[model samples]
Target: MLYKFFVKYLKPYKKIVFIAPIFMLTEVIVDLFQPFLIQQIIDKGLGAGNINYVIRIGFFMCILSLIGILAGLSTIYLSSKISQNFGGYLREDTFKKIMSLSFKNLDHQSPSNLIIRLTNDVTQVQNLILMSFRILVRAPLLLVGSFFMAFFTAKSLSPIIVILVIVITVVLYIIVHKSTPFFTNSQKALDRLNTVLNENFTGIRAVKAFVREDYEINKFDKKNENLYSSSTKASLATALIMPFLMLCVNFGIVASLYFGGQFVIGGTLAVGQIVAFINYLLQILVSLLISGMLLMNVSRAIVSVKRIIEIHDMQPDITYKTETVDNIKGDVTFDHVYFKYSDNDEYILKDINFDAKAGETVGIIGLTGSGKSTLADLIPRLYDTTKGKVLIDNKDVKEYSEKSLRSQISIVLQKAILFAGKLNTNIRYGNQSASDIEVEEAAETAQAKEFIDKFPEKYEKFISQKGSNLSGGQRQRVSIARGLVGEPKILILDDSTSALDAKSEALVKEALANEHKDTTTFIIAQKISSIKTADKILVIDAGKLISIGTHEELLKSSELYKEIYESQLGKEA
Candidate 1:
C-alpha cells in the first residue's frame, strides 16, 4: 500500500528522496564509530596508564559526533520539505475529486469522511515519509554495522543480539496487526460524529422551538463519546508495544555482560576485545528497539493511505469535458421525458412533453408531491431523465458543456440561501461586476428595497449566516434579486414567492413582467393568484400533466384545477 501511494504522489519529488538517503547513511556511519572510540580509550589509555591516547580518541569522538549532528539535521530538513509538499498536492487532488463527483457518487461518502481524508489522513502519510528518512533508514544500517563490528572482536556475543532482534520483531508485528482494524473503525466513528454535529447545528432553531435541546444534546454526546472510546482503545493497544520491546533490549544487554565476562577473565579474550563486544551488543540492541518504534508509526500510516486511496480511486458519475458554448438561445423542449431516482421505484416524471419558446411566461401549479419542481429541474440537468431527451435550441442538453448550460439558466428556490456578506454583495452575486445602480434596481423590482432601506446602512448592511437575521419574506426577495441580476435567458422560480403578502407578491410579479419582457420564465407556485395572470398554466398531478391552459380555461374545464382555484379563492368554481 505504501509503495502504491508513493508511486502516485511521491514520484515527482525523486530528487529530494534520492538525496535524503545519502545524508542518512552518513549519519549512521558517524554513529557507528562512537562505541569503538570508547573501547580504544578504555583499553589503551585507562588500562596502560596512557593519558595521551585517551585525549586523542576522546577529541576525535567529539568531532565525529558533530558531523553526525549536522548530517542528521540535513536529513530531517530534506525529508520534511518533501513530505510537506507531497501532502499539499494530495490534499488539493482529493478536494478536486470531491468537487467533480456527482450527487450519485457523493451519496456514498459523508462530508466528515471527506474532511478526514483531506486532513487527518494526509497528516498520517506525511509523518510516515519524514520518519522513513529519519529513523527507518538508520535502523537497519546500525543493526548490520554493529553485527559486523562485534564479529571481529568476539563472535560469542552475537547470539544474544540475534535473539533480541527476533523477539522485538515478532512483538512489534503482533501489535501492528491487531491494532490496524481498530484504528480504521475509529476513523469511521469520527465521520459519524461530524455528520450528527452538522445536522444539529443547521437545525438548531427548529430543535429549540420544539423544546428538543436535551434530545439533540444527548444524541450528539453519544456519537462523540463513541469516537473517543474507539480512539482510546486503538491508542492503548499501539502504546503497549514500545515498553515491551524496551524490556527485551534491557535483558539482552545484561545477558551479554555475564557471558562475555568469562571470556575476559580467561586467556581467550583480551580486555579491549571484551570492551568492544559490549559496545557492539548495546548498539545492536538500541537499533532493534528503534526499528520497533518505526514499524508502529509506519503501520498506522498505512491505514490512512488506504483510506485516502478509496477517494482517489472513485470515478465521478457525471463526466462532461466538451468545449464551453458562449452563444446560447433559450428555447427548451422535453420530448416524452420519463425519470425515476431508482430502477425499482415508480417514475418521478412520466411521459412528459412540453415546449417553452424564447420569450414566454409558463406557470406550473400542482399539489404537493406532484413533481412540479422535478419537471422544472430537468431543464438544468439537476438529475438525468430515465428515458427521454431534453433539448435546448434544437440541441440535447447533454451535448452542451455544464458551464454553458447552467450559465443560461437561473433558479430561486423556496428556501432562500444567503451568505454572510453585505446586502449589496448578496444581490450582486449572480453578476459580480454589476454596479450599485443595477443592484438597487434589481432589489427594488423584487420589492426588497422597502425593508432593506429601513436599515441604517441600507445596501451595505451585513446579513448573518444563511440570512438567519432576516425575516422569511425579506430573505425571499433578496434571493430573487440575486437571480435576476444575472439577466439569464431562462429564469425559474420554484415557489419563490410563498412567503410574501398579496400586495408585495403582485408588485414583484408586475416588476418581473415589465423588466424582463423577453425572458422565458418557469414559475412553480402553490398559489393560484401567483399563476393566474401567466400566459399559460400547467396543472400536474402524480408525475403527469393533467391539464394545460390559461387559468380561466382551466377553471372552466378541469375539475382538479377548479377545485384548487376554489379552495384558495374561497368560492365556488
Candidate 2:
C-alpha cells in the first residue's frame, strides 16, 4: 500500500525524485571522503611535519565540504517540492473520492475522522516522502561506505562495527514494532477529541442554555487525556532509540581505543588509523540513528496509507441504471418499498406504497421517527430502497443520474442549514443563476422578506457561519427561500416551518400553493394543523402506510387520524 501510494503520487515528479537522490549520493560521497582526508593529514602531513601538504589537503577538505553543503541544499529543495506537490494530489483525490461516495458510505464515516484523514494523515505520508529523499537515501549509502572504509583502515577492530550494527538493528526493530500500535491508538484518540470539540462548538448554545459547562468540560478532558496517554506511550517507545544507539557508540569507541592502543604498541596499527577508524564508526552510528527514526515514522505513515487506500477501495459511488430519463415531472411512487439504514437490522420504512401526481400537495403525517423524512428522501434518491422500488415519472429513481435526479427535487430538512455569505448568496445556493427578482420572490414566498427588509443591507447582509446570527425562525425562512429559489419540480419540506409561528407558517404555505402550483409538494409536519388542509394526507405508523385520504375523509374513515386531530384540536375539534 505504501509503495503504491508513493509511486502513484511521485509519478508526476519522477524527474525530481530521480534528481534528488543524485544530489544525496553526492553528499554521502563527500561525507565518506572527509574521514579519509583527515587520516591523510594526520599520517602523512602532520606526522612528517610537512606543513604545505597539510595546508593543501585541508583546502581540498574545505572545497569538498562546500560541495557537500550545496548538494545537501539541492536535495532538500527537490525533496520538499516533490513531497508537497505529492501531498496536494493525494489530499485532492481523497477528497474527491469522499465527495463521490454514496450517502450510505458517508453514513458510516465520522466527520472528524474524515477531517483527520485528509489533513493529519496526508501530512504523515508527506513527511515520510520528504525524509525518504534525504535522511533515508543518505543513511544506507553512508553506512555501507563508512563500513567498507573503516574495515580497510583497521581490519583488526572490525568486530566493533559488526557487533554495533547487529545490536542496534535488533533494538530498532523492537522499538518500532512496539510503537506502531500505540501510534494507531493515538490517531484514533485524536479523532475522538476532535469530534468532542466539533460537537461542543456547534451546540454551544444548547450547552450554555442547559448550563452544562462542567459536563462538557469533563467530557472534553476525558477524551483529551486519552489522546495524551496514547501519544506519550508512542513517544516513549521511539524515545529509547537515541539513548540505546548512544550506548552502542560508547561501546564501539571504547573497544576501538583499547584494541588500537595494543595494536600500536605491537607496531601493527598507526595513530592516524585509530582516529580515522573512530570517525567512520561515528558515521555508521549517525546513519543507524537516522535509519531507526525513519523506520518508526514509516510505520506511522503506513497506517495513514492504509486509511487512504480503504477509502479508495470502497464501492461507494451511487450506481445509475443503464436507462436514462431527461426530465422529472414529479410523478412519484413507492411500490412495496422497504427501507433500512446501512448496518441497521430493523427497517425504518416497510412495505410502503404511495403515489403523488405532478402539481399535487401531499401531506405526510406520522409519529416522530416513523420514517416521514426517510420517505421524502426516496423521491430524490438520497437512499435506495432495501426492497421493491421507488419510481419517479413512471421510471425507477435509479434511471436518473444523481445530479439529474437531485437537481429536480429540492428537500428542506427538519434542521435548517446555511453557509457563511451574503443573504442573497445563501438563497441563490439553490440556483446560482437565479435573477435578483426571482431571489426576492423566493424570500417573499418563504415569509423571509419582512425581516430581511429590516436589515440595512437587506439581501446583501452578511450571514454568520451556520446562520448563527439569525434566530431559528429567520434561519428556517432563509433555508426555505434557498430551497424554493430553484423552483424544483418536486419540493419536500420536512417540517422546515416548525420554527415559524402559526401565522407565518400559514402564510408560507399559502404562498407556496399560489407560486409553485405546478410543483409536487411533500409536507412532513408534527402538528396536525400543519397538514390538515392538504389535498392528500397519508398517515404513517411504525413505517407502514396506515391510511391515505384527505383531512375530512381521514377524520371520518381513519380512527388513528381522528385521534391525532382530537389530541391537537381538543374543544375545537
Model 2 lDDT per residue over 381-441, tens place: 7788889898888988877877788778899987999999999999999999999999999
- Among all candidates shown, the one with the greatest lDDT: 2
By summed lDDT, which 10 consecutive residues of candidate 2 come out lowest? 317-326
Per-residue CA lDDT of model 1 for 1-573, tens digit only, reads 557778778789898888898998999888878877777788788989999999998899989999999999999999999889888998898899888887667877877778878998889888988888888888899889988888877787778777877777787778778877778778789888988887888888899999999998899899989999988888888779767866876786677777877877775766777777777877887787777667766767888888888888888766665878755668878899998876888998899888888878899999999999988888877777789999888888888888887777888999999999999999998788889999998999899999999999999999999999999999999999999887888899999999998899999999999998877899999988888898888899999988888988998988999889878876222
TM-scores for every candidate against the unseen true structure: 0.92, 0.97
Candidate 1 least-lDDT 10 residues = 564-573
Kindly report the root-mean-square deviation of model 2 from the true structure over all alpha carbons: 1.7
Model 2 residue runs over 4 Å out of place are 321-325, 570-573
